[model samples]
Target: MTDAPALFLGQSDQPETLLLSRANRHGVVAGATGTGKTVTLQIMAQGFSEAGVPVFCADVKGDLSGICMPGSPNEKLLARAQEMGLALTPKAAPTVFWDLYGQKGHPIHTTVSEVGPVLLARMLNLNEVQEGVLSVVFHVADKEGLLLLDLDDLRSMLAYVGENAERIGREVGNVAPTSIAAIQRSILQLEQQGGAAFFGEPALRLEDMLRTSLDGRGQVNVLDATRLMNSPRLYAAFLLWLLSELFEQLPEVGDPDRPRLVFFFDEAHLLFTDAPDALREKVEQVVRLIRSKGVGVYFVTQNPADIPDSVLAQLGNRIQHALRAYTPSEQKGLKAASQSFRPNPAFDTAEAIQGLGVGEALVSTLDEKGAPRVVGRTKIRPPDSRLGPATDAERAQIMAASPVRGLYDTPVDRESAEEVLAARRGEADQAAADAKLAEARARADAAAAKEAEKAAAAREKEQVRLDREAERARAPARRSNRQTPVEALTKSVLRTAGSTLTRELLRGVLGGLKRR
Candidate 1:
């Protein structure tokens, strides 16, 4: 096998033997902060890009933007590449930038309704009841044709349904009020943490993510997520959603010579914080199964323990950076990271990590013919791409030139949960108003009936009085100067069995005109 220009974290003595063609196999990169983790990630992405395989990686510190431009020729960079026997090519790989915020890169968006309940429940850390209620929200959204675009839509729908829980719950099987409230609370928390910004229409397309430039160079897609690292929960939820989407959307291509795209998940530990056992198992399952689809997942973290052992096992190519063993736990972590690799006989693998300099790491990758290359104290090569972030102008230019630039730029509302729940609220308000109107009508009818009875009794009493008066005075005393309108109304209401306020209220409700 020929020694092709290497694009990886560390140098290799065997050069061509390690093929890493097993699309079934993946890789991992472990290193402490500032220990050149980003640079190492860049190397792998560059390597895969050169291999004509597009790479997907998160730009946690905003540095992966450098892939958009070729790296400058520095004295140190040239020396290192020369030392590694790599004829330095002053050329950058084709690349694209993506962001959930739509700020630094093209917007990568997805709808909450599409995410569904199972994954979302895991996201919110919802209990069984809360999960069930969440499902109800999804069901309602689907039945009503409401798209759960963003967090607000789902949050509003949850509240709207909760307001009419007694009625809607009864109709929709068993939607517990308690669970709805709990899910609502979780939604609020997610909103406050900025999860609302992720969902909407014109969602990210997996096909777009897997595309290359017209020049046939795989586009290295970089995500700008500097602010997201602060919100661990949101970060984890978003990452999991991305992976699940890839699995669900991408076709089963079986094993190709190389992965169509590779995903480098930085800050991998956040992915498991408070995750339920079942969801964690599901993640492991996705990681294991996605390889057959020709997608490689590389997790970058500070320690091996950050990854679940089940997930740790699926990583085939391993790149370990230097770790500080000042504390007992740190020392233990170093040993574990070292033991994870199939040892290279040339160097003491355990000590190599502490002794490794910045821009250097211990690499173990598949050989050219697709075998595990002999581990060596390999010198890492400088990236042919920029060592740092692309300039603002560069990002803007690339974004403008991006095929997906205008695709997700404008957010779409699409008659989703927000619209559905808004309509439902309008219905409820109308229903309440109608009920009030009916009640008023009933009172007016009753008042008219009572008025009829009172008028008859008064007429009868007058006849009796007149008859007696006629007997005494040979003529009935004529009743003149009839009672005033106010007095007449009071006298009529007093003859009824109802209270005065009720009669007055009824009169007001009937607008002083009882139906005859």
Candidate 2:
């Protein structure tokens, strides 16, 4: 077997922390402040990176920058190195930077819709009723094939479904208007906390995070979450989305010699605090099942009590750092942390937890035979990477070179809910406007025809009046004077013309009525 401390974990004396190639299915790292917890995490991450297993870790503090460059060789560092028995060689490992805020690292992004309602409800710390309503909105979106690609899309969709709850319920089934309304209101509150940025395209692909360089070094994916940690809801929601995505997307690989992706979750307490029972159960289930997919999840926290019993039990490999017990609660937390490990006869674990020096941890891990190793206090190896932040120019250069820059740098609005909904609304408005115009035109035509008919009747009346006056004048003249041939012809012509005019006017009136 190889004597490399990176692969074999702790030595035979400290067999408890000695993890075999196969036993690192998944695990947790817990300790208090000033403990070597962060360093322990660094060691594991670097080890996994060396093993050609892609490692992803969240950098809560600014100090994890050391992982980006090799540590400087100093006498104090060399002394600590000898105590750990690691070769005094400083070296750097492959690393990639990621961030939620565009300022820190490569912008790590995801759409709110991809996160879905199940996980969002958990993140928002929604009540049961609120969650139920959120589910209805999601159901409406899903039934209609509305892609919830970002937060805005979801917000717009929720507003739509809420406003038309009855209609949606009839068409798609069970969209409670009350629930919809509540969800809409909750969404606004969520938006206030920078939820808009979290939900949109330019989303990170799962493949990009799990990658290896051409030189055979595993890529160390670092999440720059200095600001995101402030919002526990978003952070927790994102973690769940990430975990579930891996579980669902990745195929089962059974037990592999090494993990395909090693995920490091910092500030692990936020994940379980006040988490809904349903959400907690789901998380527990994913943790148990994800190991077979060649994924290793390592949680980083100051206190072991921060993790739930159910989750704590699934962590096969463990690294225990020192804890300072200043308060009653802290003392209780420390005692519980020590009890999590297998009892070792070498020293009192409870006493040792308080006495361990920097870079030294009470370690325990799985042996080559897949058994628990004896817990022992051992010095940790120093990382080859620089323990300082990278320059802006260097960071910018690295991001520029990343293959994922062009891939996820652009946003895709797509033909999702926004487009489909807008089209439907546009069509309805156009139809309404067309109907109004048709009605207005019909009224205008009716009024114009009535005026024409009135004019025609009036003209016919005037013609009859003029003919009566002429006949009266002729009768008087014919009666008073001698009979004349011209007068007689005039009377006969007038009679014939009167009958034709009367008939023709009546027919025109009938035709006008029919047309109307």
Q: How accurate is candidate 2 locally (lDDT)?
A: 0.76
After superposition on all CA atoms, what RMSD does each candidate show versus the true structure? 19.4, 14.3
State TM-scores per candidate.
0.81, 0.86
Deviation from native of the Cα of residue 440 in model 1, angstroms: 2.2
- In angstroms, how far off is 148's CA in candidate 1? 2.7
lDDT of 2 by residue, 279-330 (tens): 8898899888998888888888888798888988888777877788999999
Candidate 2 to truth, TM: 0.86
What local distance difference test score does each model get? 0.79, 0.76
In candidate 2, how many Å is residue 5 off?
9.3
